[model samples]
Target: MATYDLIVVGAGALGAFHAYHAAKAGQRVLLLEKDQYPIGATVRNFGQVVPSGLAGRWFEYGRRSLEIYRDIQSQTDLTVRANGTVYIASDSDEWVLANELYDRYQAIGYPCELLSKLQCLTKYPLLQPDYVVGGLFFPDELSVEPEQMIHRLIAFAQKKYGVDYRPGSVVVDCQSNYGGAILTLANKQRFQAGRVLICSGHEVRLLFPEQLADAGLVVSKLQMLLVEPVAGVTLPGNMLTGLTIRRYESFQECPSYASIPKPEHLAELQKWGIHILFKQAIDGSFIVGDSHEYADATKAEDLGFHTQDYINQLMLTEARRIVTFPLEVRKTWAGFYSQTKAEIFEYDVDENIRIITGIGGKGMSSGAGYAEASIREMGL
Candidate 1:
């Protein structure tokens, strides 16, 4: 059989982006997925591409991803909409962080708008006036329907870049040689590639369990809800609240962040890691979420499979406090993603085999840009 230039395992956002970049660079690529479609963290996310929430290299990656996403949208429909992102501060302390973050972005020459309480109310009528003081807005950010975007992206890559995409093909084995790597499917069929990149999200036991067990990866379980479409309620873009302003990594970069006094009243929210955010779907329903719960990758089961009603209640209680529109939870589910203390997990099994996963919530924000850099670094 002919050896391809690259083989990407797992056609999720991370893997698909890596394949996209390599194929775009004129490399022969093979993309494989065990499932009929990507249904992991890639599709089960808020789909908010808010680089404003990131810091350091990831911030840079997110910025680049914005361009890549916009470029792709220009080519075909990826469900990408440039509506923007806003962080509405509820109190003086959170407002302080918002202003500081705005100033930080200004210094870096990134475009951002500082909105007055009146401007915020005018722009987003659903926000509760009492709950919002002032806001920091990034007009360049985007929102996507995760399921639609990933599927469309795969199709676009296949048509435009000539990528060989095989879905529902389970990879049973991976072995590396000096020339490249070999992958065996569950049906006993095999394929060869000059290099193999595993972007398998949180499922690590299939290939290199030993390397991953000690890779310092932790699986984060996030709970989210979908509110039934409230008629005539238009909450534009990504509506992030005081809790999000206080929790996002970008706010931590501000000089005043370290000293901002925590609100004792929100102790329970802190305990549950709840951050209230709202995004309107094309059908007019509001997508609301989410709370973070974690366990070591090897013990991801500890995070549990059942949805905790208490967590959903906590999120709804907080969301109702921020928006005026009625929130009748229509659906709720849990999303799993892997994360480490570092930005992302990268391991090399040999010269031709590499493992990249554990991007956390930054996958949609930074995956394209990071994968581009990764492909270039590998000289693919």
Candidate 2:
């Protein structure tokens, strides 16, 4: 058996970050992925690294993740662009919540600006004038190319940090003991390590299905779209509409969050759990998404991995209403992540085995920081 300091499963954003942190700390880590490369929720959603939207420990982690990103990028070629983010409000109701969040940011002395209708349009001229009343511009937020960031991160870890990355390996059997854990791969290969960190998102069942099930793990499905870029289109950063205010937990910290005004005209949209966000990819093509649905976490794949036309129609309709770009759905798909009622579901099954997944949609936003903290707290 090849022994190492730590073993990581999943190889997604969370797993990759865990392995990266472990390796950076001088721990020899064996990072395993079931697929040849990760094609799960990690790469499927918008790569918006917005620390300003996270609160408490997660917010701190996000800041650390940014620092780490810069650290790694300085030593290597991984790129994290400072594109920033803007949350636009279409009417008085969304504007009410927007100001509430801005007030909280002002009180905390965060470097962010609340933009009036004129300023918002001046910044992002691409936006439809009638659709935006105001916006909150978070200049510190960063973004990455979601589809390629992990693959590049994995390469950086392996080349620069010497993290032993093993792709296309699935752990069929995992046995934990006081001294260490033994993982048996489907190909009958075995790896022994002092501890195991399971960051497997939906596949946590492959290792500890019982723990995941007992934790009441549910799957949150998101239907997303990538629209063909217009001949000439530009955005301030990632754009979050009024829907995100109700969806993201960070906004809850504002004193007026609980009592933020609600626009009754959007009742139907809210009923379907639809939210609109626009992010421009590195290639300049825009990514627009998304609608949410819930199902038994274990049955998410059985539900299908393709987009639902009805949901996409609803999403595109809303997207058009918010901004105009001669939008055409160049591509459509669905991604699912583990969801729980808690901030994040991280647990230790034993002295030598740990699990960290079920971060919901925040994985792309605050995941790296969360993983770094997890490694430090465990003294790994």
Candidate 3:
């Protein structure tokens, strides 16, 4: 029998981050994951640490993460790209919204710039003027190779802080007994830990249904695509469109939303079809997304990838407005993340066991910050 100070289940972004901080804090930590490789939402979507789409405290946290990511390439073996971000508005109304967000972000000391349509076109000719009116730019945003990020974090934890990793070790049960917790794995192996932090995403309920029963936590499926960049065209950094402003916290937190006509905005929402976020990869390819669909009863097969007719048409229609190159679609995929009706899903399953989940879809942006907070809360 082996013992540790903390046992973190799930090796997705959240779990990996928690394990990293715990190990750095000198606690004997064990991280368990059912898959040999991380194959969840953590690595499925764009590896963007978006500072512009987060709320008050989360926005600050994202800024800090962006700073960490910028320095991480030198501090560790992680692959980080600080290419910044751009938000394009397709019409005058949306331009008003973009200016409103830019002004508010500036007031709060967030690094951003409001760009005119001509300025955007002159800087990046791939953008078709018909699809864009103006653009907002964030000079501090960044992107990472999601798979590379996880692997580097794992390596950093192991080589630098001595964290124990147990991939393919599925946690079947966890319970608090006496002063500690007993964790039973799928192979009938049992381990003890002074504290247990469940960073499991959508599967959190499968392990502790009774505890999280009241939290209205559920899984959301998102579809994303990767496209080959048109030759000679380069996106300065990451990119978002007016649609992103409407869906993400970037617009909702701004005064623009308050002044926008509700009926007109709602109509625009339907017209855009889905949120459009674009980031150029180190390979010169662009990763774009995404569509949101939720249901109480989710089928494994229902998570299949298909060219969403509406989303595909809308993205291509909009991408041309922002980029100069002729884009060609490459690959498409779907991802799932836990979404809670509340701010976050944090509760003690028992005295020594705590379950923390539900970061909505902003895990990549806030994963590290949340992990640091979770470890501190556990007194590790």
Candidate 4:
């Protein structure tokens, strides 16, 4: 049997981050994934890394993650797009809310600025004047091409840190032993590890069905889309809508929430219209999204494309207010994110076996920090 210090299931954002940290710590790590490449939530949505959307604690982690991302780019060949982010407000009320958030974030020493609609248009000529009343700009935010980022992270872990990866290997069974856990692969191959961290998002339940029953961890399906970018018009940076502020804990927890109009807040929740975040790929194509739908058993046929259309329309309407680019639909898809009632779900199924999941939808932004914390907790 192959033996290692740690075994990580799922090669998504959380899994990759955990594997990277474990190998960096000089632990023998094995990362197993059922797919040939990551086809999960990791690569399915906008790749914006917004520190502003996270809670205060997570925002701090995001700041650290951004630093790691910045340093890793020079060490690895991953394409890190650190263009920053702009939160656009469509109405006077939203502008008020944006100013309030800007003040709060600035008070916490976060780099953010409140800009008038005219200032935003002057700064980014592609912006449409009528759509934006004001904007919040975060100079430290960045984005990456999700596929390239994951591949590069995995390559760095293996080549530089000696992390072993078993792609296309599905873990069929897990048995806990005294010192560690034994994982049975689909091919009947067994691997032993001193510790096992289950970063496998929605697949966590399938691996430990009985244990997760009491955890209230369920699956949420999110629909997303990609749009062909306009030839001459390039977004100055990433963009977020005002609705996002209402949904994100960072904004909701802030005293700025008092500035948001009650009727507007209710309307947003009724439509589930959190802010729309947009990021342009290296090729200049923009990835847009997303709407959430929760379910216990999510199947291929159950995925919705019309939901993407609805979200796209909403985004375009908002985008028209900020920029004058003609967008053409390129592709639409859906991905599954694990949802837990709690902020994070960590449990010890056995003394040497641990499960870590429930990053919600903030995996890309906060996964690295959580992975580091998880590793420390495991003493690996």
Candidate 5:
């Protein structure tokens, strides 16, 4: 007998959400994670679930994620906070870009406010006054405590729907067997399921290295850090500055975004693909770098355990220029995730085994809804 209706590999946000939705729909689901718990890009990056910064179908997916997160919080008592997002414009060009984005947002009836310099300062006293020009505040965005989020969500899914979650067991081989799928663990243990999904993040090297290469999969390495605020300092919400306007794809919708030439410094920030965003924790600490480096899948094997010191320095240096918070580095780490030029990445090796991954930085922002829709379409 097929022991489980579905066996989902990887316990990151993507895998967890797949397990969640399948189990919620009354299937016998098993979620497998190699480590004791998920510690991949899911937990390592800023957990700012910002729909306002997403464009097209992804923005809709992010909106659905907001509702799902809210529902989970109410149903399971998990921590999904409504912190919102503030994108600041520090110069004329950036200010012009913000206005264009604001106009387009107003046309679409998106709930965003374009605040004047005085309004920004009045609302967020912690913002460095000298760096403020004007800003856009997206009132609908939300955030999650990343470090604790995945674990709690999986726990809730387990308790509410009887999801069989197995941690510390790594899948070494998976193949079709006996009209179903059989996954072999590192310890030679085997499990069967009618359907199997591999949501293994950038670690595609494990199952489908050849296929991932064909799909143009690349590894995006990011340098990130967490810092404690000066005693009693409080941030108004998730913070972004001019640097982000160029990085987030959603901002490209503004006509000015295309016409405005990047200033030397901003151009330099763009050259390295640095995205400086901030999300404040419930304890008042802040999560903040994110410098992007893309490695071809062929060289992804050489992609090693290294955090570029110069890149980290560049990130912290730029962060200081945007805001004046006394950010003492409490913890820092590098995060890795898979990305492709494709908007969505998923395929099937056979009818029974499917691969779903590579939504890039939107994993936390758009993952839940994407998973829900993909599962429905897969009919699994």
Candidate 6:
């Protein structure tokens, strides 16, 4: 039987980074994935690393994650791009929230630029002039090609750090022994490890159903679409709008957030949790999305696999109101992720086994830094 210092189940962003850090710390690490490649929230995301959208420790974690991502990119190509992020305001209420959040970021010494109406129009010509009142821009953020980034990161870790990575290896059982845990694969092959970390996303029912049922986790289904590349149009960075200004967590933390009246007309949009954001890919196509729908983790099936056309049209309707550019949908799909009332769900089944999942949308922005911190906290 082969033995390892750490066995990380699920090679998504969280698990892969944990394995990378463990190996970087000189521990023998094994990374396992059920599918031939990662096809979860890690890849099915907007790939926007905007710390500006988060608050508190998550915001700090996101800031650190940016640093870690750049460090890795320096060593190899991880599809990391420093294109920056901007939040555009359409009305006085949203405009107030933007300024308030700017003050909050300023107090913390984070760098951001407040743009005038003309500045916003000058920077992004595709934006409808009347739709944009002003904007706030964060220059240190990034946008990545989600489909390509994870594969490159895994390959880099294998070649440079000597981390053992196995795909299509499904773990059926994990039992703790005297000093370590034994992991049994679907084929009945077994491996031993000093500790096992499960960052398996929403697939927790397979390993520990009782804990997952009582963990208060909810699965969120999001709908996003890709626009076919538009000729003579260029959007360089993450473009967040008025709806986003009203919906993001950072804005909720602002002092004026409570007093700002919610528009009664937007009730249906709020019911579905729709927020419009745009990011132009290197290939000139635009990635736009998304709306949130929730169900208990146990009832994830309630949120079916089919994408809702009415929901997509609601998004496209609002999207058209915001931008003049053509939005011919190239593709549409649903992405699932888990979350809890707490920032993350971390349960220690025993000293040798821990289950960590339910990071919500913060995975892309904060996963790397949180994993590094978790390793030190675990003394692994």
What TM-score number comes out for model 4? 0.92
lDDT of each: 0.92, 0.84, 0.78, 0.77, 0.85, 0.92
- Ranked by TM-score, the better of candidates 1 and 5 is 1
* Model 6 CA deviation exceeding 4 Å by range: none
How high is the lDDT of residue 168 in model 1? Answer: 95
Tens digit of per-residue lDDT, candidate 6, span 21-135: 9989988999999999998999998989999999889999999999999999999999899989999999999999999988888988898999999999999989998898999
Listed in order, each prediction's TM-score against the native is 0.99, 0.96, 0.92, 0.92, 0.95, 0.99
Q: Candidate 6 has what TM-score?
A: 0.99
Q: Quick one: RMSD of model 2? A: 1.5
Enumerate residue pairs that collide in model 3: 125-324, 126-323, 126-324, 126-325, 127-322, 127-323, 127-324, 128-320
* Candidate 1 structure lDDT: 0.92
Q: Which digits, one per residue and each the tens of the lDDT, describe model 2 over residues 1-380?
A: 89999999989999999999899999999999999999889998888888777888777788777777777767765657877888988877667777887887778777688999999888888888999889998887888888888988999999878999999998988898666999999989999999999988877568888888877677888888888877778774788987877667677776666776567867767777888988998777888888888877867766677777888888888888888678887888888888788867888998889888888877777788888888898898
Q: Which numbered prediction scores highest in lDDT against the true structure?
A: 1
**How much is 207 displaced in model 6, in angstroms?**
0.3
Q: Between candidates 4 and 5, name the one with more favorable TM-score.
A: 5
User: Which lDDT value does model 5 have at 198?
Assistant: 95
* Model 3 lDDT per residue over 347-370, tens place: 887779888887778789987876
- Candidate 3 yields a Cα-based lDDT of 0.78
RMSD of each: 0.8, 1.5, 2.4, 2.4, 1.6, 0.8
Give the runs in model 1 whose Cα sits over 4 Å from its true position. none
Candidate 5: misplaced stretches above 4 Å? 301-303
Q: Name the lDDT value of residue 369 in candidate 1.
A: 94
